[model samples]
Target: MRLRAITGFFFVIVMLGSVLLGNVVFTLFYLALSVFCLHEFNGLVKQGTADPNLYTGLLNGIFVFLAFAAQSYFPSKFLLFLLPVLLGSIFIQELYKKSEHPFNNIAYCFLGLLFTITPFTFFHGMAFISGSFNFHIPLSFLLMLWANDTGAYVVGSQLGRVKLFPRHSPKKTWEGFIGGILITAGVAVILSRYYTEYDWKQWVSVGILISTFGTMGDLIESMFKRSINVKDSGGILPGHGGLLDRFDGLLLAAPIVYAYLYFITNA
Candidate 1:
């Protein structure tokens, strides 16, 4: 457990630094991490009851990385490239041997892509969001997420009684989830005072989304692990299970907050 915390802390530092560096450094780091995570996720599928398709996973990872990078760098070209590539991949994969679960395999492959790579585009988007308020968006999002996770663990351990989803994730409780939200909101309120650019309302909204959707994100990953009959996603992070285990909440929270800000401002 100590080792896990140390390793996780270091990982967090490196990741946060990469984001703070905010340029090609973070982009490359993010891409590499995404590939590693996708590989780890696909490894779980392969190690279990299903026959693992290595090439499929690799291709899917590439496409997901390309899609995200293109979306961040070239929005107009992203869709133009994304649709045709998706159709082509499906068509090519379909032409191969028709297994009993051909579509099932392909679907899972794509689902892995979407779940792993799509949310990360939000981070890329954050790097480019202009305004005096934009500089702190990523840090604020990350800090709120960290607060939520820490609060849930501490509070839930002390006072968690009512189960949130006993079957899906036995340890998660309603009390813990609410505790996480309150703690995260507290942090948000404190930080909002310092942000002279974004209104307090915007920060509060981000806080709410981070805590609420963050909990949902944690549950979603739990559902996936439950479906696969596993405790942790993998043994990569010593005690934390896998990359997905670490980033699950961030994955869900980032996109939601990004979209909220985007639509609110753009619309």
Candidate 2:
């Protein structure tokens, strides 16, 4: 427990610092994070018999993220053209690399991008959600997600009786699920006071989405880990597991919440 708390504390500090420092740090930090997580993900995929194209996949991940990051910093159409070249390079390279289950390799390569790159691209796009880089939206989103996670764990450990998803994660409970939502909603209320871009109601709605989808994201990752017969994604975080384990919630939550913000902002 002490180790977990220590890890969690530094994790929170670094995450918060990355956002608060400025866009340069934010971009660098998350870009490094995306690559690290994808690397970990690749390791997980390779444990099976198929080998994913690490370099090409990493290139694609880098390109995809930089493409969006560039747009956030400065708009350009020329950067958009690089997508096909990078993505197509995966297939082209795969054609020459002789390996058993070649198609499986190709599939996992793209899956890695879909799994890591896409959502992260959307997350980076969040800073520009208001047509400029303001950390409030991204920072608020993380806070709410963390709040939900902490709330669920505390409540689940103590008051949990009924299983929420016994198939994937046995320890999860309905009481904890609701507890998370309530805690997230409370955080949203606090966020409302500072981030007036959206009122209390919208923040609360975002909280709900984070708690709901975030939990689903956790279970989905659990399902993936179980299918592979792995315990944690990696040992990067002491008590947590890996970057994947820590940010699994962001996998699903980031994209959905970004869409929600986009829709409302445009609507």
lDDT tens digits, residues 1-267, model 1?
799889889888986887677567767777777777777777777665554355666666666666656555556564546656664575467557556776666666776667877677676676556532244777788888989999999999999999998877799988999999889888888888986446777787888899888888888998888777888887878867798898889778888888888876666
Q: Tell me how many residue pairs clash in candidate 2.
A: 0
Question: How far is 34's C-alpha from truth in model 1 (Å)?
Answer: 1.9
The estimated TM-scores of all candidates read: 0.88, 0.97
* Model 1 misplacement above 4 A: 48-52, 74-79, 131-135
Candidate 1 least-lDDT 10 residues: 126-135
Looking at candidate 1, what is the lDDT of residue 256?
82
Q: Which residue segments of model 2 deviate by more than 4 Å? A: none
Cα deviation at 55, candidate 1, in Å, is 2.9
Per-residue error at 140 for model 1, in Å? 1.5
C-alpha local distance difference test of each model: 0.76, 0.91
Highest lDDT: give the candidate number: 2
